[model samples]
Structure formats: C-alpha cells, structure tokens
Target: MKLLLILTALVAALAMPTSAMAAAFVVDDPVDGPGVGDPTDCDGGAPPGNCSLRDAIAAANASPEAANSITFQITALSLTAGPLLLTKPNTVIGQERNTTITWAAGAGPALTLEPTLTGTGSTLRRLVFVRTGGGAAGDPILRIQADGTFFDRGQLRNGPGDGAEVTSVAPATTDNVTFAGSTITGNARNGVRGATGARNLAITNTIFFGNGLKPISLEGAANAGAGAPVGLRVGPRQPDGSLPLSGTATTGGTIELYRGNPFSSASPTLGDSFGVGAGAFSRVPPFALAPGEPLATTLTTGGAGTSEFVLVSVPDDIVSPGLTSVRAINTTQLRMRLSEPIDPATVQAGNFSVEMASRPRAIRSVSVDGGGTEILITTAGGWLEGEAGYLQIGAPGSFADAAGNASLVAGRVRVAAGPGDFTPPRLSNVSVTPKKFCPSGVKRCRGPRGTKVTFTTNEEGRLELAAFKGRKQVGNRSFTKDKAGTYTIKFSGKLRAGRLSAGRYKLRFTMEDEVGNISPAATRTIRALGRKRR
Candidate 1:
C-alpha cells in the first residue's frame, strides 16, 4: 500500500506544472538566525521559525519542484554562517530591492550553486554581496556550477577573492553564464573567472572596476584538445576610469567585443604570451567596426593582456568612400564629392563607370581634386537631360583608405541628370568709359587712360570682354561673378588702350555659364576721341 501511495504521489507531482510545484521560501531575519526553515511549514512552528537566508536555501533544496525561488523580507542581513550551499535549481531574489548580504571572514562564497545539481537553472539578482574579511585565495563571492545561471543587477565588492567563478564539474558538461546590469569591483582576483568546461559566457550592461587582477580570466587546459572551446561576449564599458576593457586567458578561447557609438575594432596585435598556431586571429569584412556592432575573434593560445584583441576609437579606416555630393560641371562633365580622401591611383575610368536605360555615357577620364576627396569624371558625350543612370565604384579593394584598409563592398548609386541651365547669363546695362588726364591744360598728354566696364548678369557666370580694331585683336578682360552674381572689369594706365590714335574700336561682351555654354556675344562700338588741352 505504501508503494502504491508513493507511485500515486509521483504521478501527481509529474502532472503539476513546474510553477505550480515551485515554492517561495522567505527569510525574515535581519540578523543571522538558525531554524529548520521548512518552506512549507516555517510559519507553523512554535514562535515561527526565524527563517534566515541559510534556512531559506535549505528549504528550497528540500522542495520537490524542479525550480524554486527564495525571497527575503528583511532589508539588510548578515551571513555569519559562511557560504549558503544551494543544491537545487533556484532563484534567490531580494524582496526588498537592494538587500545587502554581509559575509564574515572565513566564510566561503556567499552562495555556491552546487555542481552536483544537474539540469538546474540558478539566478541571483538585486542583492549586494560584501565580504568583510579574507578567505581562500580562489574563493569567490558567488560560485556558479549549474548551467544557464544568471547574475543580474547585483554588486559584488571588496572581496579578497574573485567576485564570481563559473565552471562545470562534469567533464562533458558545459555551463553558460551571463551577467547583466551588475557591478564587480575591488576584488583581489579576477572579477569573473571561467574555468574549464565553461563556455558561452556573456557579460552585458555590467561594470567591472578596480579589480586587483584582470576583469575576466579564462582558464583552459594546457593541451588545446583537453578542454572545450569557450566563448565570451562583453558589452562596452561605462566611463569610470581609463582602465582598459581587457581579458586574460590561461588557454585558448574566443572573445567578442561589442563597439559603442563611434568606436570600432581594429586589427588585433597579439601579446608576447599569445601563441601563433593553426588558426590565428582574423577580422571579418576587413573593414572598420561600425557603431553598436560586435566583432568576434578567436585566440588560440593563452595571453595576459587584451593585445590579443582590442578595440580602438580610430578614424574610420575601412569605411567605403561615400559620394557626398554630385553636380553637373558641364553637359559632358560631372563632379562628385567624397566623404574622405581616396587613393588617386584607384580613381580609374573603369572604377567610375555608369549604366543607364539609354547607352550610358562612357567615362573618358577620372581625376581627383587637389583636396583628394573629390572626383571629376569627364564623359565622352553630353548626358541627355533628365537621364537616369547608376554610378558605381568597382569591386572591393578597388578603393582603400590611407591606412590601406579595404573599402566596404562597392554599391551602385542612382544618378539623375541635374537641371541643365540652358539659359546663359545676360550682360545688361553695359558701359565702357575711358578717363583722359594731362599735367597742364595747355600740355595735352596722349598717354594711357583709365577704363571701366560695368555690367549686370541675369544669372551667375563668367563675363568676358574683348576689344578689336578692325580685324586685329587689341585686348581682352574676364571677370567672375561674386556672391551677389555681379561682374565689373576695370583697366587703368597702360592696361587701357595706351596712346590710341582716336579711332573707332569694337567691344564684344559674352557670358559663359558654369556648364561651359556660351551666350551670344553683344557688340558695342566706341570711338577713342582724343581730348584737347583747355
């Protein structure tokens, strides 16, 4: 009959959901207290059990659920009894946010998730663990042995040992641990250690500062074949000090660094202790790191510093040359602005080729501007008005930064014929006056004179004026438009018609648009009438 009852209970337990079977054990004592602390009957005991953290853990283990949670009612508590051994899959949460766990000297870990508890998921959150005295060399404030354990929103500080250690006892078992929104600092050893058989560890939104040793340490077997491959993902560090975000490895492992805004992963320089083996470190895309992106690299040997793989806030080295602005220099010439300087050698006719619905304009030549950041492409023929086409830089590595980092995969940009200013600038209100002078009125001098030509342009462009005596050319002057789109040309002394024998001279005025289109020349006749002495 007892056997039948036991079987019936097992069936009922199996039928219940994991949550239904789970129990919540509460610690009511601010000061360490001792009692049986049976989670199911703590309140039933005479005077009610004290229910210390130690008792709560014990009760959680005794529960039959696969997953249990232990909550504390006290705001502050001290653990004089040493490490609380957790032997089951449990979550220990502080009911009152920011509860403090003070560990006395000689106390082991504040909490040790036993390795013997297979297939358990453990979590520690919203609690502060402060060690008052020194313990063993390798003792950690929190030791995790179960797979899929999480440490969230907690602070582990001032410990004489590591802040946390994650490892698996079973040779074949691998534990995955994650730390989020937590602070691990002031520890004598590494803030977090991943020993043998620990893999897939991730730290996100956490801060590790003032730790005596490296912030993170990965220990693997001396023989590469002896241990499992470990992987670590670290988020960007907060601005506290200049302490570099780094990691140390006793064996082979992989580190993935996530970049913040404006930061990128550069080619890693290996440290002295790092070994070069079959698989050396390599970067993907061979380009600059983008903002808020993660870069993964493998380390085949142990090393002390982050030189194995480090991030730098470098000027964008591998960014593909971007076309910042485009303008039609003329009917057959196009100007393109680049975001950064490009190797002039890479600016080839084939590199700036175009394709369109109609026969694309063949690139006659590609040249870089003096600034080295702009490209001028002269086409074989004028582009049709409103023509649509695609402009692309050739394959990868065709263009590179000064640092020699290859550009990103080239991409095509849609190009459309810009509005062509067919209407040429008008040279209206044109006038040319010659100034005559003499030392004395009686002595009339037939020397040089000052000449001024003023005109207005309906549009912006260059203005050119030429003088001709019959078919023989005399002189010419050119003026560029100012910001207000106005032009004036002046000639003085010998620059003007020097000692001209009063005669009929023809003046020609023409306006050339920015696109090299010339307007009809306007002609004006002026007779250089020599002045007489008064």
Candidate 2:
C-alpha cells in the first residue's frame, strides 16, 4: 500500500505545471535590427538574429517570466527607429566603459518605461544616452512610468528636451524613482521633470548644467488631486535626515531658487534667501504640491556647490555710476559729481577721457575729491570756450563701486566750455601825432604834415584806432598784441589828403582780449589848423 501511495504522489507532483525560469538576454549587436520572432529566444548570436537591443527588449517584454535582465556588450549603438519600450519588469545594464546609446533626431525617447507595467526591482545603470535629434518639445531622453525604478551612474546629454520625464498615471500609484550619480547637461528644457501624478522622487549626486530652463521641475495636474510628495535632497543625505551645513559661496550673477509654472495659475513661493550667493544646504522654502501645478529651480549662471549642498556664489549688486553734474574748475580741470561713492583704486587716467569734435582730449590724471562722490579729471590743456565736450568715466570692468561691483557700461557727461576772461582790459597812454600847428598871428591853425595815433593796453589783444574829421571821412588802423601788458599803434598819412581841412578831428581807440572780451573805447578830440597853402 505504501509503495502504491508513493507512486501516485510522485505522478501528481509531475502533473502540476512548474514555474518558468527567468532568462538573461545579451545584446551583442550594435545595430538597429528587426524585432524578435520568438520572444522566448535569447541565444541568437548577432544582428539579423535575435541578439540586438531592440529584439532583446521585445523578448524581455514578451517573456512569461516575472523577472528578467537585458545587458549590452557593445561599445556603441544607434537607435534608428522608435524608442525601446519597456513593458515588463526588467533590469537593463550597460557594460562598464563600453556602452553608449545614441538616438536619432525626431525619434521618440531612447527608452520609455510604460505606465501600465509595474517595475518593483527594475534597475538601469552604467549607460550613456546621447540624444542627437527628434525629441519634441515635451519629450525626454528617458520616460519613466514604473514604480520603484532605480537609475544609477548614467549620462544623458544634448537632448532637445528634458533628460528624463517621470509620470504616474491613474490607479493613483506612487512611483518611487531614485536617480543617483548622473550628469545631465545641455538639454533644451529641464534636466529632470516630474510630471503630473509623479511621487516619491529622489535625486542625489547628480550634476546639471547648460539646461535651457530649470535643472529640476515638479509639475502636477491642474485639478486638486492627492499626489505623492516630491523631495529633492541635493548632495548626500545624512543619516540623521538633516543636511550638512557648509559655508557661503558666491555666483557670477543672480541665482534663482524656484520659478512659477507657466501652465498653471499657481505661483511659486520662494524663500527669502532665494537670490545669488545663497549658502549650500540652505533650506528651500516649502511650496504646495497640487495637481497640475508646476515649480522649478533655475541655475542661470555659474556657481559653487559641494557634494552635499547647492552652494551658490553671491553676485555683487552692480549699478552704473550716475553723473549728476560736470563743472570745469579751470580750462583743463573738470569736477564730476556722481550719485554714489566709487572705489579710489579704480580711478585711473585711462578710465576717464574727454571727447570733442576736434579729437579726444588727453587725460592727464584722474583723482577723487574730498567728498568721495566727485571725480576730478585734468586734461592736458584747458577747454576751449563754448566748445561742446563729453566727459566719459568708468570703462567696462575697469571701474567699480566701493562694494567691488564693476561698472558694466561706461558713464558719460555732456559739458560746455565755461565762461572765460570776464575781466576787460585796461587801456591808457592815448596820444595823437601830427599835432595841429598855428603860425604866429595866423588866423587859423593848420593840420600837421601827418596824423599819428598811439595807445597802450595792459592785456594782449587786438587794438583799433580810428581818425574821423567832424562826422564825415577818415582812416583806421588795427593791430594785435601777442603778450599781455603793453602795446602801441600809430596811424599816419592822409587824414585823407586835404580831407583834414583845418578843422577839429576825433580819434577813437579800442582793445579786445583773447577770450572775446572788449574794453571800453577811449576817445580823444583835437583841433587841426588848415595846411597853409601847401
């Protein structure tokens, strides 16, 4: 009886269907071959056979086993057709230092993990994805819809869209996606985008640069739905759950911490310390995570950060120095009033210059005034009276403020030549030659053989002499003096031949200074006797 029972039990055990064994697919071909004919086949050697990446993915998806793996041994491969869709829980790993996946332009994502599938132990590691073309506006190099997916040590670059886009669909599942030790750069949009229904996303030890918008963007549906919280811990997370604090750092310009979503009406709540030079490991302001709402953090300029913190250098507040007033202290010196104090060391002769229609004036020196808000510019020569001139100060990067912020643009001031030589010249020693002579007992005095007038001035200027007979005819002489102090001018010959007919005559003298200042005219009257029957 015992032998018969053992025989029946053994038969029953053999009748039961056994679980299918998990299989490993090795992709040896680097070409875009056709899809697989038998999804259960993995031993086919190379291209046109079953060992290509596309066929491997298709075989893994079609396999009846719950767990499977796909690995590559090629140095490089191109995905010429559509994206390799992942419909099953599978681990795709690239050979260390030897595997690269390049997607053609306008093609779909390089890899898309379908939302309909559940990936509890799925992992993607040690791979490089170069998106050459064809990713549309909202497309990404990697699209994830699976739960508990892990991406490690990957490089995604040069894509027309985001590096990765993660979304969770209806069944309201919580997709806990973790990405670590990766680099995403030169993408058209965000480095990583968390679309609506995404949840429990974590990023660590990832470097992002040259992204068109934010490095990380969190978006949700427009309606209010219960979505899983998104937490971003930049750097390594400590065991105590608190971020390690570090010293402050500076940036080239203003660094924005968070941005508002253009698609939704909700605004981002940025912390007070969201500007440039924010410390690494600084606590970012908490914002609402609503459905259809979007939030992002942008890194527009270069900054400093550590492995565990987002340390950004503070940008100096640079304001162009404003010119309030420009005055000429003398012909060659100008005093410029500024809106604020400037750095003394930045003031140099090369930084300040004068320009006119003639040419650029040479800057002899530049100095700061006692008030600290004024700049003194001394030219090689005095300014010409009434000439239009421009005083330019602060060349780009040459001049800075007291806080070390450089002036990005040059500052200019328009000025005119100041009033000059207000004082009029003094004239003296006025005398007329060819004195009238009267013969003793003669009835009328006669004009001398010639008439000469002379004068002296204290300033170097043009001198004029006029000789008039009664209110009618006469002669005039003009001359110029090269130096200040004294000058003389004489006029002779015709008081106009017989024109000075034994009568009274008037002599007028005037002088004009170099700066166009005219002195009062000096006049002298004298009687001339008629020439005796010459």
Candidate 3:
C-alpha cells in the first residue's frame, strides 16, 4: 500500500498541468507567527496584517487549483509561528536571493513538506532557510519526506541533525527530485544524504560550500555502517577482473560535478572524511591519506568503532567545465568565463552564438584566451552597448575542458553588460517567426506547425507575453532573461477554453528592464488553421 501510493503520487505529481489555474498568496508580514494559522481565515491570523508565511501556506493548502504560490513582500521571516507543514504542492517564492526564512535553535527543520496523498509537493525559489541554533543532530534544513520537488536558486544552511541534509523516510523510495542553481552550506553532516529507500535525485548548477561533513552521502546502510563487513572493499581493478584493496576502487558513487565546494575536518577518525577535499568528488574504496595529511575531522572510513582512514578524492577539472560568470567588455566583445581552464584545441567560433529578446544573434568569431578559462566572442557589428542577451555555447560534445565531459548550460545563457548596464531595456527587430501559429490540425502545412516568437532587446529584462484569440485571451507565457539579449520563446497555441483551434491570435509582448523600467508594448498576429482529420 505504501509503495503503490508512493509511485502514484510521484508520477502524478511530476505531471503538473500547465493549464491548471493557480491561487497566489503574498506575504505582507515578516513575523514568524502566533501559532494557529489558517490560509482561508486570511484576516484572522494574529499580528493583524492577516498575512504571514504560515498563513500564506495555510491558504495555499486549501486551494484546489493544480498549483498555488506563496510570495513574500518582506525580506525575512522568523519561524516563530511554529512548524511549517505543507499538505499540498505550493511554490514559496522569495523577493530576492537574500530573502530568508529562519528557524530557532531547536525548532526542527525550517520547513516540512509532508503530503497526505502526494509527494512532498513544492517548488521553493530564491529563498534561504537557516537553522539558527546548533548542537549537531541529523535534521535537514528542508525535510523532504517524499519526492517530486524542486529547490531552485535557493540556499539551505545551518542545521544540526540526521536530517542535516534533505532526507526522505516515509516512502522508502521517492523519485523525480531536483535541486538546481542552489547552495547548501554549514550543515553538520552530509550536504545531501540519500535514504536507503530509492533516492532518485538530480543536482545541477549547485554548490556545496563549507559543509561540516561530506558534501554528498552515497553509502547505503550496508556500506555506511561501521559494523563487520565494515569498510567497503577498496582497490583497483586487477588484470583478472578482481579489485585489489588499494588505490582507485570504484566504491560506486559519482558526484560528478562539485563546483568550488571546500570542506575541512579536524578529527583523526575523520581526517580522510567524505568530501575531504573538493574538486570533483567520487567515492571509491580506500585511497590512503597522505603521510602527513590531517585526520580526525569528518570520518568516511569505518564510521566510529573503526580505524584505518583513507582520503579518497579527485582533483578539479575532472568534471566538465561550467560558466562561472559572463560579462561584456565594452561594445566590442563579450567574455564567458569557465569554472576551469580548458584545452585550447576545442575552440571554434561557430560554437558560440548570441541571442536577444529570444532570437539568435550572429557570431563572427570565438576564441579561448591564454588563461584558458575565458571564451571571447565577437559579432560582425560588435555587441550593442545596452543589449540584454545571452550566449549559447556549443551543444554537447562541441567543447570540453577535460577530454570527454562537455560544458553544462551549453544551452542559452543571458549576457550581462558588466561595467554599467542600468538602461531600461528596449525592444526592436521583433518577430513572430511563425507570425502564424499552427496546431496539429493544420493539414496544409508540411507538419503540425508549432510556433514561436522572437525579439531583440537593448538591455536585460523580463518578457511577459499574453496571447489573445479574437475577444478572449488564449495563452500567457513569461520569458525571463538569463542576462540580457534576444530570445526565441516557443508559443503554445492552446486556447484558454481548450486545445488549439482555428483562429487569429495576437501575442502581446511586455518587457521589463532589470531596474524596474517597462518597455512599450509590442504585438504580433498569427493565424491557426483547423486540423485535417486523417
């Protein structure tokens, strides 16, 4: 019964329908709480303003919509109201990177997402959850009892407990979990510890900084235990297919890309602890610590009651290169910096392209400077000074810092005008490429014609697009800039009433600059033809 429910919730939860309406609750107060809170009773919560994180979450829980959102107006909130429990999926979005949600010393985890009939359902964006007091326990900052969740561009730090790292215990196995563009620091134990249950997880563009223990935990109960059959048999693959207890034994865990995460331990038993040294970490059996290497910090050996420590680690550059920063150097060129130096031989001008407002820009050439970490590219006309766009590095296999690993985010990356880019973004060269949107029913076209809109911008900004068919609104999509430039946003022609149908629709583009400047509205028209039944 437990297993079935787990699978059902995980699968259903992953299919978040785009058309489902969402209820939004905005936080007006930063006070943690006055205990008993109810979302539906919006005006009754104590502290009078009627809106708090606890209250907002309560309101979202009662919402029947496919998705609900809780946004904060204030910068910080104390969990004084009590434990935060989410029964339904909700998005807790913060005002900015520094927006914080804090918990008292022994308050337990900052937030708990325990769904009754679903996964630990929620997406937390741009918020920081801090565990204020200490006393190393294994509690995680975010207690993910289930799966099917996303923590994007957020931070989780300062916790002491088994849950020290996000964990899952209810459903023995949870799936479809992702933590992207985020940071986890100053935890007592593992940065991310997986449950014995299926911990199907993915990490992208995440950094683990100054973690008390391993940045990641891969040992199952069997291996993590220090009892007899104690340590994982470590060694290299011998000529006869046998692995001898020595250097380079695949302990069988790959934390492939760990970006600039530094860890240090001061315990002899843990001198050669998990994630002892950063670079790119992978777990293999027994690689001895250097003769004079420090020990007794965070142990990875045989746990406690065990001895003989090994400092198994991989150096930087073993993982693929990633963008650390992007900036425009005057109007003449732009530089995309990488996490590590690359082999100059992989350089190719054709591999890089620029885009503004959702459209691609031309690239005359691209080259890797002597530093090996900077990729300087130029367009025929040089970069537009106020342009807000992004650089599209070559696709997978096009470039590699190390021999085989390709750079991540080769997709579209926003361009940032480094020196002074405060100008309100402007739109130009706007295009509705299919200026006509076609659904599957349109037989006259070579294929079921899908459609997209493209436009260029003078500075980095956000684009909110509203599509209207006849007198009614059909679709709405927001295009967010990575830096600032051109973009080609795909338009799903689905009508507000149902799927796409024969009609003339107008796409309204509203662009907003980084510094709160809104641009003049731009509109494009497209016609959709009915499908030809087979």
Candidate 4:
C-alpha cells in the first residue's frame, strides 16, 4: 500500500498541467531547466534538470484546492525574465543577500500584478525588482492593482513608471498601504500612485530621482474615474443632478521619517554643542566671532557644588541646547544664541527658559534683548549654587543642555530689550490715525484693497501687522528697520475686497525686538467693505 501511494504521487507530479506551470511562477535559469516539474534533487542532481525559478514559484503556489499559489522565496539566476508575476493572492520574497530579480530588455515589465485580488489580508515584504533594459518613458517596472499590503526595500530604474502603482479606477476598497526606504529613479511618472478612497497611505525615506511628475501622486477619492466617494461636496452636480458629498477629491502629502526631524515634529537635541573659549565672549556688533578668537569666560560657583546651566527654546524644533550657545556674559546676563535665525513674526519675548543643573539654581528671570541674540538670566529663589555641578536647559523639544534635560519656567523678565540695545524698546505715545477710509468713533474702516496704514513706535525695532475678520489672520505684514522704527504697509494681501463679507475686521499690530521678544497685540478695528464692484 505504501509503494502504491508513492507511485501515485510520482504519476500525479508527472501528469501536472503545463500551462498552469507557465502562468504560475516561471524561472528561466539555464541550470534549472525551463519546465514545470518537481526535480528529484535540489539542483536537479547537478545536471540540466535543476528546478527553475518559475517552477519554484509554481510549487509554492500550487495547492490541491487553491486556484493559484503563494510564493515564499525565489533565487533569480539572471536578469533575463527574472521578475515574477502575481495575478492571485500571495507574496514573493527574495531570500539570498544578493538575490535580486531583473527584467530583460524589451520585456513587458519586471513584475505585473493585475487586480482580481481576493481582497484578503496578505503582507508582501523583502523583495526588489530592477529594470535592466530601457523602455518607454511611461512603462512601469511593477504595477499593483486593487489592494494588499506591499513593502519594498529595493531599487527601480530606466522607465517613466519605474516604481509601483496601486490604483483602482473602479469603486473598490484599497486602504492602508505603506512604502518605505525605496529609491525610484529615471522615471517619467510618479513613483507611487494612490486612487479612490485609498486613505491612510504612508510613504517614508523614499528618494525619487528624475521623475517628471511628483514623486508621490494621489488621484483622490472624488477624482477616481469610478471609485468610492469621499468628503463633503455641495455644488458640482453628479449625473443624477443630485449633490453627493463627492465633487472633486483631493489628498494631502505628509512625511514621516525614522531619522532626523524631517517631519518637523520634535527638534534635534544637542546639535554640535562645542564649548567655545572665553574670548569668543567679546565680539564687535553684527557679532561674527572669528575662529580661534581667544577670550576667557568661566562658569563660577557662587557657593558650593557645580551647578549646571541649560537653555531651551519654545514651539519645539526652534532650538535645542546642542544648537544653542550659552555664553557666560557678566554675572547678571547670559547670552543665548539660537541654532538658526528665527522669524521675528513667530517670536514671543517671555517664551523661553534657562536652567541650572541644580533646580535651586534655576533661572530666576529672563530678559531678552533686541537682535534676538542675548538673554539676561538671573538665579531663581530656590537656586543653590554649587562649585562642581553644571547647568543645562530644556524646553519641549526646542533646546536642551549637553545632556538632554527640560528647562523650567521660573519668572518673567522685568523688561525685554531690543537686539540692538540692552534696554528694551519702549513706546510712550504712538497713534494709528485713520486717514482716508476711516470714520471717527466707528473703530473699523471700509476702503479700497490697497489702503495703506502707518504705525509709529516710540523706539527702534521691527513692527508686525495682523489683520483678521475674526480670529483668522486674513492679512499679515511686517517691516524691518535700520534705526528708525516705523511702518507704512498696505493691508492688501490679507484683506480682500471680496473677503469683507459685510462685517468689521479686527486689526492688531505687534512689535518685536531683535532678541526673540514681542510686545502685546495692539488692537484696533477696521470696517471691511463688501464684495460689490464700484
């Protein structure tokens, strides 16, 4: 009975269908004969009957009941017809370190996986497809239709559609797809294509080279010729003239990175904090400290253990301790230099913190000066100065000491100074006299789009203008100063004639010193004109 079972298995294997082997997983290795049949040995017993790549794929996919089989691994012998096809549900993984599949010149593609997916949950990973032969600019090396999770850490080249495309113009579900660490080069079309309601697709650390279109493109739900509907749509009537919550779909792009602060989330901490010599302390204004400038600055102990001084900035990613310079400037003031120059519009004077290793030695007061370069730090009440401890700074992901630590907020500064002056800029009597379009006591004004407004500050500093219909900033304007701090800019960009919508608009002006500090939002009202033509 056992012999009969073995003979039966052999006969069945010999009688297996040939077309199925051809359309299944086909390999063209010279050693592995280009046929569909189980070899008696791994490499056909060191002869011409070695199992080909295509036969290996067929074996993986063939099940007594399965219409098609799943491919676990394949070792391509060469680039001639090296890529595998997928018309059914399964995964193709390259197993060896140098194992890669290449498509032949004038070949249809490296891999062509059409739709008709069972739409079941399956994961594909650890595979690479290379296009060795040049072809039409728009010819894709790999095309994936319908839906399934496909992950690639591979190389693609020499065509318009070199990478991969997951598109279904027909209304079908293709959700939750992700791509990472892939390089697509010399292509005419985008590397990845998303269509219909394909939401929550994430792409990361993928470099696109020489693609005519955007590296990543989404057709959006509404834009899909026949896909699922998405979002709230009011106007463009559909075929039935019924307003479905689907007019023109759109998709937004966001980057998620495993290395560095590419997402602009948290700032990079401790970026190259090389402590300079004390002599870098003294510098001419427009402080360009020449390299190797010798000066002496010391971190002294008022009493006991060494106290650590740390600095941190606000709105994470602004500056980190490593990227900031904490110079011991006199006993009363410490100058903090930011990693990059900050925009004056986004700065608020009291929004930073300086800390000491000893909580007791934490900063007591912070006085920011103009030019946004220097900060005056005074010891807090709880600060217990020691001889040996060091000081560190921290602020939400903004800045930190050599060792990453959070800096606490102790107290507000008595006054904020300009970058140009240790004394904070002050305004005694400055006025916004409504000129042509303004009416007395009405507060708001309605005038032409390019109406110019003048602001006068008692001291020299930068001025920021903000115009809003309510809380939304419709128009914002800024002007830099040499020594005379005054501004006259048209509230044109933010204030549109059509944006008035028949109501009063709020106007506020803010003043900032060179040191990252800003004054309060000075409030005023301006009546906005309607959208009517003159």
State which candidate has the highest TM-score: 1
TM-score per candidate: 0.47, 0.42, 0.40, 0.38
Against the unseen true structure, what C-alpha lDDT does each candidate score?
A: 0.59, 0.59, 0.57, 0.42
Give me the runs in candidate 1 sitting further than 4 Å from their true place.
Answer: 1-24, 33-43, 46-49, 58-69, 87-98, 104-106, 117-125, 132-138, 146-155, 167-186, 197-210, 221-257, 260-340, 350-363, 369-371, 374-534
Question: Judged by TM-score relative to the true structure, which candidate is superior, 2 or 4?
Answer: 2
lDDT tens digits by residue: candidate 1, 1-534: 999999999999788776556667777765553443345443336244367777777777776666677777776777765577887775555643788888765467778887643455678878898888636666889888777677888999878788988767766544557777787787888788777666666654555667777566677631223222233322121122111223343344444343431112122222122232233232222233343443333333232212122333433232455567665545666667565566677656776676544567788788876244457777885566555566776765555435444444466766556556645566677776653322122225564444667777777678866666664445555677853345556643222334345567777777767765456567777655455666
Cα lDDT tens digits, model 2, 314-428, are: 2222244556777654567676766555677877787777875456878878888523456778888645755557777645654555655454546676755555655667888
Clashes of 1: 0
**Winning model by lDDT:** 2
**lDDT score of residue 174 within candidate 3:** 50
Task: Please give the TM-score that candidate 3 achieves against the real structure.
Answer: 0.40
Candidate 3 stretches with Cα past 4 Å from truth are 1-19, 41-48, 90-92, 95-97, 116-121, 134-136, 162-166, 169-172, 219-261, 265-534
> How do all the candidates rank in terms of lDDT, highest first?
2, 1, 3, 4
Number of the candidate with higher lDDT, 3 or 4: 3
Using lDDT as the yardstick, the better of models 2 and 3 is 2
Sorted on TM-score, best first, the list reads: 1, 2, 3, 4
* Model 3: per-residue Cα lDDT over 1-534, one tens digit each: 999999999898779675377777878776654564666545333454668788787777777776777777678877754457777864555544567877763356667776455424577788887877622366677766556677788887767843223454554555445676677777877666655542445554555656777665545542233222112223222222222222232232221212122355221121122332312233433443222232111222211211112333332123556778776654656777665556677778877777753456577778885245567777654445565668776565455653334554557677775345434468777787665556754566444367777888876778867666543344566778867677787766654445566767776777766644456668788777665565
